[model samples]
Target: MKRVQDWLLRFRWQKLLLVWGVFLLIAAVLFAERSGVQYTHTRFRLSYLPQEQAISKAQALQEQPATCLLLCDTRQSGVDNARELFTQLLQDMKVAADVVDLAEVSVNDLPAPENYQTAVVLMPNVEPLGEELLRLMNWVEDGGGLLFGMSPSNDRYFTVVSAKLGVLSTSGEYKQAESIVPAEGFMLGGGQRYELSDPFDSSLAVALREDTEVYAATGDEKVPLIWGRRQGRGRIVVDNIGIYDKVMRGFYAASYSLLQDAVAYPVINSAVFYLDDFPSPVPGGDGTYIRRDYGLSISDFYSQVWWPDLTQLAERYGIHYTGVMIENYEDDTLSAPERQTDTEQFRYFGGLLLRQGGEIGYHGYNHQPLCLPDTDYGDAYAYNQWPNADAITAAMDELIAFQKAVLPYAVGSVYVPPSNILSAAGREILGTRVPGIRTIASTYFEDGSGLPYVQEFDVAPDGIVEQPRIVSGGMVGDSYMRLAAVSELNMHYVSTHFMHPDDLLDEDRGAAEGWEVYKGGLVDYLNWLEKAAPHLRKQTGTECSGAVERFAALTVTTTGTNDAWELTLGNFHDEAWLLFRANDGVPGTVTGGQLTLLTGNLYLLKAEQPTVQILRQEG
Candidate 1:
């Protein structure tokens, strides 16, 4: 790196020339492709859908028997998990309903009575005015359910809303640690703090009404965190604990799940397990433990020390892991002898993984940014802020070539960008240059100057799907538990988590300590998932990506209202659920899979095939 840096310093113009040269090459490729009438950039999101009609966003949000109305000042806030996820959770659970907010809605332009199944008044900055309250009351009286929530403040409208629900609110922070037990039917988990909320407690309290049923209770007293009652023509549920937890800082406590129950949204519980940075890069030294240690190669550790233990767990738990394979870094190619050893040992090890039901994914050719190297991993984002597309394509080409020769057979479509950062230009280059890679394994929140945040996931704007690995575990059991909780928000939602194999070996002490952490921490996590969420669907990165891609390419819509609808799916899995917000209170059924409750306003149809139907039961 020093030699290369010095060379670049001495010949600075070469960098400019290199960029220009790559640009020219890209132009030439584009021109040739244009002549043949096969332009790549135009193929962007178009290629993902070989045959399909788009479901208009307007149609999906049209009037329905069920509805979720979140009242908040949109201009005053950013992304709140409660506000954003509440709707997404509904979508995943498939309860057919429309979610309306002030930004795209006006109280004057509210949906018809047939659409008002549930009215959720979220934590607004201020108590709703008299006129708004009157409207909400009338909606409830007209049969609209209400998930009434307000942020922490003893001096706020607690008195007014509590009076309306016939409950009582008090001012006391939730400092005590305790388990919450929800009533038998609530799908929102009755679990521990979602890791993000510990150390600090919530500041909200509520005393239940005598006529109300408690859904979730907190502390030794089992005080109501959420409680509901039937009033006039509708039901109203309130969880002061939830409003405090979410409004304060998105702490995602069980209070949040309890709130979902309060809203009565049907939920699909799920979990996903996978590995990251599997084929670790050999950091710059030949005599290192990774290259050859104590007369054994790193591959020997993976196969003998690593594989045996993980394989036993996989077999025991029926889990399939996707190993993110890293090829090179900053021109850090292996010596001829080392490459030969790697080729042979990897073939054997990868074959073993494949036979044991594991798969491999591309992490990157070089574990550093594609733009350039600075002897520092942190500097990658700066260099790749706007990396050259053609150079990235060249690197991707080399990676595919190497994978063909070295890794085992399942050359899947998942790619985990190095440092978890890939410029949008770099991402699109992967889609255009390597059409075989249908998905990119990346952080839930992509950070790049090139890709817009909206197009980062849910099948990125580039036509490639992004199967997000929600959380990271570095050999910690409790951490894994927290991450697992974070991943299992809804059953129909994709669950994904990753761990580094190097976590198996202590950095300073090497394999001895890491393997212990891996066994004790991660294995416990798998078991916990089995016990906590037994129905978790296990799949390789390839499979997960394919599921997401198919779903993204699909267009599910409705019109003829016999409580039935038709959908045109893409390359979906053997069993998958397509969720939608429903109008009626009663649950429905389906043929391909099953009709399950997601939320009060949502329903999920699980099935297999490019076409499926959902028939709402007649009252």
Candidate 2:
């Protein structure tokens, strides 16, 4: 006390002012809290920030209605990384949202419940309490749709939301299962048993309360896995499907279907097809179908068998298949047959396809990535072949030169890596090499396995893009899986499907089988494609690259709804129309990237950066 008095007395005015400032800060905080001001902080960006045109058309579309709020309370426990991933998944799901961290908003400044039709709470560790709880209750009661995920802390929310919304109540216990089969439904699972990551917390069998609407259920016919009910003016959907294991097992499409179908979200134009293992047939296979030697050289097979079938399919379906070009299938000693016919027959075939609205994409040199002949990330794994950077670069250059040789000016910037495997180093070779490649053709989901590379599509620090192919011509009978894959792909505004004419031949799925044997699977899938997602526009690999390049250059902002959506794309690509997944409804007119829906989510000729608007007819 004496020291304080002495100090205050010596620097009396300055010390007094400092003390007053501190006192005022504390007092103001206390007063604001007591006075019921809604305290708000912006939710940190959670999704991968896509590179878009600096001048976005979204500026005009800003005030457009929102479909959902990606809810993440920054103050919550265990929300740092998981929340960001969840946000990314939502963005990947193509759901437009305002990432709202309610903790940051003052109650007075909160937007009306009507502003957003749906409120999504995914894997939030902290249950909304106190004033936040009250605000949530008000929003739901006043007609806001609620979509929530399962977590330990979900009980508090479930109890409150269930009671108010008149939905089912649960103790928040996960029904244990090692493998559970889903009935034929669009939401989750298949008739075949699904492998669970956590056997103990596989799925939840929620007991439905009165007035609950059940759309899907488990095999037992007793427990409800998915159910929903109307609450006041809002709707509540309960998705008790657990994704922990599915995500681990790489069944990304199933997980998406469950979450999205639970709400019956509008799905349009979201698929791309790339037919791999074509033109270049690799030798020495698994003995099921990969023969010891040639039935015919790739050029003859493509010219005689695949081309006509593909061209017919394209004519019938209004689609162009992307046939990957492999310059060399074997060693120079073994490639004599390939060389003899390649220049004459192969280029002619390639040129014919290009003229027929087909696309040509690079596979690899001698069916190998830029790597030493023996460096093995795995058999057919091109991404991790080389032990060092120099080896990888050398191999990359060889491949680039090979493409230049094969197609000359016709070579596409899209590189469908051998076996859909790529390492960060291999990607670097694409970005850093002179006359480097632009887009990558592989699944968006990649696992780097704790290496220097990131398991993803987009190469970091450089602008190498990845256009992921979501569907392949496998499991020709699994219509629902195809549906899930296409819808999910559409969510990202990119559709990719790959098939090999070989697969149509052998007992194997992706083998280079003859056209006569392969046509059945193709026919079934194409018919299903027409029936299921006919609205999605199909583009050749070249067009897909053009669209990606165009989209990358454009500023994109989206206004979305359950039935319709509008993407205002700025800085459009010249002669580059972006194909969008939209419904077979009113495709609003536009200048750039004009909209068209084939049936469910297919279309063609989306001019680059088209400000397309989709209008859903109110049923």
Candidate 3:
């Protein structure tokens, strides 16, 4: 009996040993796949097809009835701003405009006022136009739309047309407007007041008639910022918000739509959410917050706690992330680029992101900013500049190779500058050597001088697309929301936001509020965005760059009749998106495009061909 019991015990011990062996083998296999040191390279390539203009200049400017006249005075101080506003905002709307400089054309021999549906005056002091200004005003009284691009000047000429402008009286003093409060439905995501950080005397101190409809006003005292009134058979829309910049383009764009019966403009129609320094080395941050809440280390908290929550949030909101990889947290600028071998974290996170319809782009070989040695980072950033261009090239080359080895199927087209500080030399190197880098995502708004490289949504002269992020961070504020709303109306823009994984570690970035509170703030903004603009397309960073490329390459000309509107696109791509506003007609049917109703009378049109025609019943 003792011998039989010993045999059974020995058999049970062997069985347990076999089980442990199997577990060890499985762990080894997983470690091999997740670690870069044991990588098995594959031949999957991701490419970026840069868009180019497909139509000639003559074909672009097709014969169309001029719907608007953009009048500017070269002698005026704000003329350049007016022209830029017209070019960047109004021209892209497909509204055919006859731009005439007052300095070039004699006031006596001005173009006929009967040829236009609306006239935009850019001159601050219209006294120089003599009696010619009256011709434009008479046209307005006779069923023509008129828009004053700037606030009314206290000159005698403007006082003569005070009644036409809906002004009952003027204090002849500029009123400081610290906040902009748009009425509900005046613009997308309206009703929230935006307080200006740098308030100035921007709005004119004027009272309006009872019939005048105020669209926006100053907070607190409720002074009118923008208002419109009916004059005779036509209408007059006054843009009293005197601010002019890329940030203010949307306000003016929305105000311009008030003049036309129906208007349409091309749009990118994509919203991209970028993750900077994601899937990199565990950031250096205090784990006190993590321990207090989840009882986990900073590394464990990121993987076990933070990631699950963030991933759930993205899934809930249908947000696909575009994570820019930072190979290492080392600030190495002088040494040769080194490959990261312990890439288990990157493999785990990056795989999940890609599987969930996300993308992986380049952040940097290290945390150092991509500036030359001489570049001054100022006090805004503490990043070290690269020693030389060769060092940058070597680092970037290694990063590209490493990403290709790890993520062979993912596209490396989008590149976000580390710390938003890329010097001119760094930019040149990127444009020339880094052919795979098709887009540079930078900041859209400047916080301070020498802080960040501000960019616009346009193709650079170097053929690389510049798609700047409008707002960032998890703690979304009213100013950021307001900016997002304005840009949407003006450019048919979708928001580009960026966030870091280590935000919870930094006290200034709401770490003390804890993950629950910080995440709640982010969720609130996402909910607001979903409710406000549900039709915005959620795309990865590269996809957004492609959309911007198409928008920048295309030129459109619009022609309108009593019952139909036709748009001819110049650089027709495979697909294009546009926003069409129908004020006096119900859009019936569309050819070469499909229409989706957005809000109020606004419709989103997706065009697949060069020509798009909308048939509508005349209202």
Leading candidate by lDDT:
3
| TM-scores, one per candidate | 0.69, 0.63, 0.87
- Candidate 1 lands at a TM-score of 0.69
What digit string (tens of lDDT, one per residue) describes model 3 on residues 1-619? 9998788687857788778999999999776545533423221222234444422222343554677888878788777887777666765565668888889988877787778888888877888778988888888788788888887788999999888889999898888878888777666667777776567887788899999989889987788888988777777898887777667777777777777667667787887899999768889988688789989999889878887887898889888889999999987788889899977788777766776678888999998878987888667677888888889999998888888776666667788987787788889999998887888998887766675778867777677888888767776665755565555544655788888998889888888889998888788778777776788888888888777767766666666777888888777778888877775578888999999876667678889889999998655
Candidate 1 lDDT over 452-531, as tens digits, reads: 22222255544566666655563435543454443344333445677766543445423444455546766666665565
Error of 1 at 442 (Å): 1.2
At residue 385, candidate 2 shows an lDDT of 43
- Tell me the RMSD of model 3 versus the true structure: 4.9
Candidate 1, number of clashes: 34
Compared with the true structure, all predictions reach lDDT values of: 0.51, 0.50, 0.78
lDDT of 3: 0.78
Question: Which residue pairs show collisions in model 3?
Answer: none
Off by over 4 Å in 3: 1-68, 73-83, 91-117, 141-144, 230-234
| lDDT (Cα, tens digit) per residue for candidate 2, span 440-488 | 7776443444222222322234555556665566554554345334434
